[model samples]
Target chain A: MTLAPFEGADALVRRNNISSQGPEGAPAIVFGHGYGSSRQMWRLVAPQFVDDHRVVLFDHVGSGGSDRRAYDRGKYDSLHGYADDLLEICHALGLSEIVYVGHSVGAMIGCLAAIAEPTLFDSLVLVGGSARYINDEGYVGGFEADDVDALLDSLDANYLAWASTMAPVFMGNSDRPELTAELLDSFSKADQAVARQFARVTFLSDLRSDLSSVSTPTLVVQSTNDIVAPVVAGEFLRDSIPGSRLEVLEAEGHYVHVSDPEKLTTTIRSFLG
Target chain B: MNPGVQARDLFDLIPCGLISATTRGVITTVNDTFLAMVEKKREEVVGHHLIEHLTPGSRLYFETGFMPQLKAHGRASEVAFDLCLSSGETLSVFLNAVVDRERDGGTILFAVFDATLRRHYERELLAARRLAERSETRVTILQTATTAFGNAGSEEEVAHALADASRAATDAMAASVYLCDPSGGFSAPSSSGAAKQLVEAALLDALGGRGDPSPTGGLAQSPTTVVYSGSAELSAHFPSAAAALRTARVEALATVPLIDDGALGGILLASFGRPRRLDPPTVDLLESLAQQSVLVLQRIRLRELISYRSLHDPLTGLPNRHSLQRRLDQLLTGTHPNQPTIAVLFIDLDGFKSVNDRFGHLAGDSVLRRIGASLERAVRSGDMVGRLGGDEFLLICEDADEQSAGDLAERLRATVRNTPLEEATGLSVSASVGVSIYRPGTSPEKPTGDALIQLADEAMYQSKRTGKDRATIIRA
Candidate 1:
């Protein structure tokens, strides 16, 4: 498994020379984990791509194994700032014509960076990407404004309840209850205000028109029954973008990458080839 | 657990009343606390209607509204109502009603608690706070009255009013007024009966009216001159009144100055026999009253000069820029939708700089002042003329569209066509005018004070591009 952590470029850069195990000159494929998960999301999927491409996987700023001191709310108010860090990493590694694989908010950041600088990425593979997580007129993303507001209020009202309720879902375990404590520890690492700001920018940004201007070859992979990102939203993205393709996998829950990695990996490899 | 024993023990130990009511409002049960609180017996009230146990006034309230709410909602918590005792005394209680649907189809359970003491204490506390706020308002009004005399219209009126108010405030017997003369003389200008007699008999009699003539006669002198010139020395000059006035057990003696025409005109002297300390703000207010008297006297001198310069501009003897700018800013900030467009043409001379540079500044000054007169005659009566700065002028034309602004710009350009020093030294002089029309929504960029001027300045430079002695109008 390859580790690729996304840290803000303006933040203190940690010089961790984590070794890469893939083709030396192949276009780099950087993976971004979704909310409440870490770089380990790609552990099962990275092995299949490592032999053919330069695979990079990392935790987002304030997440697992990344520099914790680098998270600042003033600088990281929008996903564009996160996209800036993604571009910085590409520039740092001298990787061009790369493919970005992002989940949830990570997918939105990839789309933003691609829109802002079209030539930086050759293609974007968005897994569970939503232009806006909250629904409004002419759009039917899952959550409403009040629902997102309640989620934020609950996150503030009781951190312990928030951790207990949300950690298990991200851990994607019903049979093993012991993984909940480990997931809670990861969620508690960043300041609560910074976490709330990140949630607001992630869930509230409207990127419907942005998909129309995307010149990169795009692949949107969604879960059919995923409670986090719905199947209709995947079709909306496919129909809106000029040449983007959508593929839905028959999965039970939101964390399909963990539940059925073999099927997800095969689908991604076939599409990329 | 034995059911009977547990039930009997629980019934006696419960804190609230537990009563049962029938469909027609008859009381079936009463606990010991409820019986004690209402001073009633279980045997007397158990079979009676619940309305019989309520006070006459409360019985009407409960039957009219309380029973309907409980029957409709099934349960009503913390309902405030009154109950009557067997002795006919009223007790305030909070009742909770629970209606049971099984068995009798509607068996009502009532829980009652005493609430009289808490309600009484809350009412008393609120009343005390209201009384305190009322007293605070009276004190605020009294303080406002004490400061009113300072803002009176005239210096003499302020001086007279302050003396009367101070005497009334401190119950003083008499008051007097003195003013400092420029040659270091303190003369009594005005006085009441007893004060005038004491000043004449004490000082004039002792020193033959020439006792070093009070060195502290200036406006900067302290209120108490006894510190700079000793009280003993003042007593030596006027022993009788000094001794009487000093030993009169007075609460306060205040002196406020009357200033007018850049000199100390007079002072108001107030003395009281009763002991009191004047508040500092009240004393400062008395001083301001004297200053108001002086300002009133000086306003008469300024009124004539003010009226003379009212229509004419003080700088150029032409109509002032204020009236011109008022008319122009009104046209720019238009009130009606279909009002005609207006143009503001900013004119600046091209070669007036070299005239000022070559000739002495006096000759340059005369030429610029002459150009102001020429520009005044060039525009029609409805048009506005203004001197913006050293060599710059502004012409405001009403109801003028782009073509009219172009025509007016040409006339202004031709009017100042002759050179100033060329008539004096045979050189050519010309002026540049920039015209911009005020239109709606043409400049999508937000309009600012500088943007309008810059638009006109750019048009003027376009005329300068046609090589001088020309006018250009820029339409938005």
Candidate 2:
């Protein structure tokens, strides 16, 4: 009868599919993934930090191995709601002066969390992020409202294809059973409604006004070319957020951690130092 | 043709597109079919990144979503994409790609299918699904409204249910219920949402002649429902209202008339922040919500009418004998320092029989109506004036002593004598008035309405015996 099976801040760790490694009590660094991805995205970059820090990784609800039942439409309607969840995860782990790294939508979520509770995060690492994706009168966010609509439609088209064809594709990889299970788990946990709503919230939300209030020391990481969050978006983020620095990496594609993990890890390590 | 040449031809002329690229998605080679599908020459596509060939949306999905799966599983299947063609329009394509990891840095081999028909089918399926969801939501809203409206005990509750239902059904930013007021203008009875002023203005403009609640006509006759797709249409129809809405940034609106018994009773209006056009089913659902409101409103009015009729006289529209009895019981039961005395004036027409005999029954009825009006004016504002059938009438007044009761009786007689019934009927009539007074603690028996009326009736007969058109007073 209880729709929310897990209650209180303590349950957030398990509910968010949280995992931690490296030296305990060391300065913690949490890694958050972007839309349509899981915490596994940071496999290559996060290990480099684990040598010196308590590395934390968790999937947002409705992605990865997180409790699929915990995905509430009302709770995750806006990025602020996701921010609340992020704050809860941080608070549950008793993390303070945390070095937070977030990619894509995760970057905005981190910004919101930092704006709400600046003391909790020492600084923020926003990778390939945009303050806003939809274009405004004077701002160029690289997309129109109609384009976002089409993006949602494309999500639907791909999701329908992903649900059926992905299983057979995974079955072919029996040589790596563990990876096969992980890939299946990642794709299987996705609900179409959640993906669509998440897409809408991610693309349509405008966080230009929130940037100035961010007191946390921030680093905006931009790829040389990213289709989702363009170079201008990272520049805008750097300009709008108070005292934030921008690092344009000589990387390609949206997922900098995936395309060039060495460059992204080195950027964060240097930013932290 | 040689077997090797034929094998090469089969690869180039395959039904689907073929591509070989590095795992990083840079194209290494493409077959003839792939070039033909994208409407690009072999030289143009051979070295380009696959993401560049995709539409922006598809490119985002490919880089973030598709590539990750491809890297992790060594292959990805049935990923949908919209390939940006040479002509600036997109061609829907379904792709299946596998990785050859034995090669340096790995090599990606891809098979692309032109899926224009499949995309068309999928879009239709999605539309169907959306329609089904909307229909289900509409039905649920209607069901909830039906229960809420049916259980509502007052008009305000009904209006509240209506506002909720209309807003839910349309998913509008705001919804308001406006009732037809006595001043002939519409007044907002209930509202739901923050954009109250915007909705009010939209309603005012959309329903021209805002103050004119002309029954069975006006805005109601022109269209039972009004829809403005966006601000422009709203401006075209209602410039001032649209101006207010524009200030609030509201873009769409739909209003349905609440008609009861062929008369416009009110209106249900919903406003949206996005440019919207209500599909046929949605429009029908809105009208159904309006109809529900109308039914509830009619029920309320009917209940009021029935209650009024139960306690009123058919002819004079005054409280009848039954109503007077209830009022007498109320006045006699309570003890108050402000009004300790109760007076009942029992009046009978002294010359009414002659008027009826001479001027017929129609004139008698007219004289009775006029006499009722005069008696009403002669009594104090707090007094209850009612007819006890035939020629008898009673006036129940509180805070009246023997002197005030006698004075009021005299005033009633004089007012009846001064009445203009004689001019119309060629006859003059007057009233023989009797007064009965009761003071608490003075009377041995507690006063009842029937006992008070009997004593007043005896006093009236005494006035009739002494002389017609005279007043008599009795203290009980």
Candidate 3:
């Protein structure tokens, strides 16, 4: 489900390449993409509901086809800035009771936006999302703080090669080389500074407090063998989000819709229906 | 697969690197072009975990963004990453992958394309944009400073304006303008900016004995722009100023000396928290600001001196006849609501003609000057005493009552009698002072300054008729 993204104030509109397609009279579903990728990641799922539900897609200001000149370091320093953009987008479109589908960092961004503007959304779908990435007491984020520092160091030393090395890890089904090739192509075109900043905002952010306030009908899409958002993390999201449902997909990695689209779509339909 | 689609994947003719790996990211296939791209044989790239060939950042990206997408989708496409060539040059590439579960545990296919040239162009564009932005900021600062300089009025005002302009022109912590007075004294008006505590200390440098005129002074030596970057360098050159700024957390300083002809007019000081390099245009902007301020300061000083000469006597530096009349006019008519009474004592010296005739005019002039000073000391603080041209002096007292006026008249008489006129060899002279009081309620005529002077003059002649060294009051 998607509704046309909002466009008011030329600077904000141009900074974020917000666009949409679907039946105007239908309920709206706004799609938020994760870091390192843009609205292009929703190509398969977004088109499926366009005939009945309004489908909205957009590239966050530092990614995809967004105007690079408008990227301000002061404004993008925290995750709240990203959430503010989401609220403004929905506000501009004059949409209420929106269906927000978020993946990875985008999922947390949606949760924060909903908390800030409760009337804007009625439901939330969190796909492979985690509140904190650093391993803490009684929490398994899978990476140590030193590991993150090393990652930043490597990014600084050779950014271009870093992208290539990351593709194999992200696209774990490396047997099918085309899957990773496409993902890499999507990453190569992004501005290096924007990419690095998005990385910092995503991993360094902690929004566990934001989850308890999300009273909307929420669904946490958990993958069986997902390495990014582990089973425990998905369970944590389901537990933290009051009255939220958890549906486990028999997918191999963190990305469920791309691996088993039928199962993910069927589960969402059942929950919403 | 169709022959045409299958032929497209032919190793040597593909014109790109191609590889395949299982779900665990263990490499299974490596094409000739891929081997050629890394300058490695098939044995080198094949049968290696994808993690082994990736850099730490790339590995992080894979675990975070890439691996998740592929694991869920079963196929991922158009992802970008870097590859280190054997020749030690970095090459950017794009990859496309699809999972195949038949032969391996979700075997993935890979297609890569070189994107080094594209990346170069994008980098060049981003750099150009940033340079343009910095230049725009410089233009805006200069424009603001030029306008402020055009409107400044006094040396103090100009110094104040320059302080504001200097801080705006450069991103400095604080800025101050120090100026030299004609008497070899230096003073800096309070300046405020990012660092207030240090600026107070910088002003103290101008206040100390360094204000003394010496051609080889610190500010005098800095006729051109000077910069001290870092704490060590700043402390070595400007020890006191450096200490203040350092305490305020400032690490750098730049000074532009203001010199008008051969004299040092002032110095402009700005403190910074980082090492500063003033480019040619920026230096020119500061130097021009200094030049404009000196011109304005000189003009203001000349105008002030001229304004002073207009209302004061050249020889004795006392207010002239015109100034006294104007002051008297203000006191008489300016009080609107309250008709508070005022008194004017007009004194005309007795026996002064014989001294000028015998001892000459030079001794006469000296006696007049000394008497003028004595009369000044004898009057109340609020009274105005003026030399209204040769031997005739006028004193105006405001807010006075009848009893107070009478007391002041007697004091004037006694003081005049006590003067032992000097240097004429035993020549002791006294004066007859006529007091005229303008009590608006009891006055017979409209109170005017000229009328009051005339009445006081007439009363002084009456004192002379009754013998000198006495005061007579004329009721007006």
Candidate 4:
């Protein structure tokens, strides 16, 4: 009936799988990984801010080294659980007026965090984020509700099969060979039960209202030839959030962070400046 | 050697695949060794991100683990990734990289090692470990189900316990338990069941859509299991049921037959939120649970049957004299606040000796059976009707007054006269009826049922003395 009171820095780090670099007093740039990869998606882009800004990288509780025991089905059933982690990390580090960079589902998670505590973030960068994955009466999220169900069923197979079939599509950069492999390894890194729950939470979420509520300046990055979040999804995010700019990347796939980190860093930097 | 010869030699040979990439992770140079390993030329290897050649999982490893560590520490070592060779074969490679920083950004140096042999055993071990974990989980689930069945109190509870355990173990959305009733119908599904329409449809489909209500004989010999994945597969077997399941968005169903000593006792139905493949160990454990469930469930049913027979008339399936007395005793102890006078009736056949003496006891027995059925039909909804002995019957009616009791007694006297005995067609049959009403005001204390029955017997004798097929009433 009662939850343990939220612990500060040490507990937040353990719960959210947080890691950081750069000078302590500098402005913070919090980076969130999407479904497939962990904070490594920000490797090529994060180093750009290492000189003057603090680069904070953390995996969602189930994805990386975060304590799996802390994962309660009731708490993590919604995206708010993930967003709360972001806020906790900010408060723990005494970070104010930070930039939140989120990829795919993480974008919506960041938006949720910003809406809850708008003072913590000054700018939001969402790459390939979609408000809803399932197409409603007039939406195109590239999948039906049943398709995601089917995908979860497919994940019921062994890790090898899941890695082979899912990694390519999630990485989406077929022209490059290593990205898919990297994604597969990332998929294998997660606990089986956590991975399955993450898939359900990420694909089944509907967070359109959260976008409009984000008071921070936002940028929506749409990648060309993206299969997961199509051009319309980017447009939806931009249109839903007030005063938000939409940028189309030259890269492709759901993992724009892995495929086109340079473009992301450039666009995000320009928007923040 | 000339400078040109030295440069050409450097490009020709190396111990391992050597490659270099710009700070942006785009490959800008490749040696001959690197080209041969990927089975590509220098031009093909250059000007492309080395990320493209790796498998999806390895791509993830590079981006999430290897690349970040490489950037943070300025060096990454012993990174394993599977690369897609030009021949469509994926090669497992162990990579080590070092960043070389200069005036114009920095270049990344990489060394690749072939790790096919090491990786083969690692993958095999991983699969074996997973199988072991799966079996361990299944063992725990079976232990829980076995314990539940061993301690069950009733047939329905056993079904419920097993369904609850299995659904949680397998992560199923809903579960149902069904037992075959003797009259070619199944009992109402247990509480653990899913939505009515989906379960009904799935039950029908699982049984191959046969109209026969007795599912015991309906099961197929081979496989001993029926599994439907998704609506399409389920539709192929039971179209109507599949339609209902689809409407409920149920993706999978598995029906395991519960056979006790080779006889069908019942069935266990499991519904899933998504299509699933039933693993062998899971299927085996389910079958074991099915067998155990039926054994317990059948035992409960037999116990129930024994209890039923103890208090019910064998021939007519009505309450016997013992059950009727118990009913009256319970009624007296818990009499309602607005209790009406309780009436007890005694009826005796009048015609009897002539037909029995002429056509024999068998003919008289049929008449007795016919009269017994008629007595039951003549009583009110809450009345208790039972056979006392040869040619004698009793009725315990609640809320009956003197006028109503007399009217019921008249109805009882005419019941035998209305239908002639099947064997003795020429003979007419009738009964003498007597009623005793126990009004609470008649006595200060609660009245006993034995006194009322005694009074009713005397009243029946009075009716017999006056004229055979008539009614008499006595108020107590």
- True interface contacts reproduced by each model, as a fraction? 0.00, 0.28, 0.08, 0.01
Segments in model 2 whose C-alpha atoms lie over 4 Å from true places: A1-7, A10-15, A18-28, A50-56, A65-77, A91-95, A165-190, B1-7, B69-74, B121-133, B144-476
On DockQ, the leading prediction is 2
Error of 3 at B468 (Å): 3.2
**Which stretches of candidate 3 lie above 4 Å from their native place?**
A1-273, B1-143, B195-209, B212-216, B220-223, B238-243, B336-339, B351-366, B413-426
lDDT, candidate 4, B409-449, per-residue tens? 88888887886687887888788888888876566677777
Worst 10 residues of 1 chain A by lDDT: A10-19
Candidate 1 C-alpha lDDT tens digits along A189-229: 34454556565656665667557878888999898755456
Q: Evaluate model 3: give its lDDT.
A: 0.71
lDDT of each: 0.62, 0.81, 0.71, 0.74
How does residue B26 of candidate 1 score in lDDT?
Answer: 68
Better of 3 and 4 by TM-score: 4
- lDDT of candidate 2 over B1-476, digit per residue (tens): 69999999999998999999986788998999888888999888987788889887777678766887788777777888899989898899999999998977789999999999988999999889777877788889899999999988878788889988887776566778888876877765587754467547555655674454456444756547878876668777676575576545456678788887777778777876545677788889888888888888789878988888888887777789999999999887785445579989999987788877887888788888888887788778988999998899999989899888888998998988898986346667788888889987785678688899999999999999998799999988
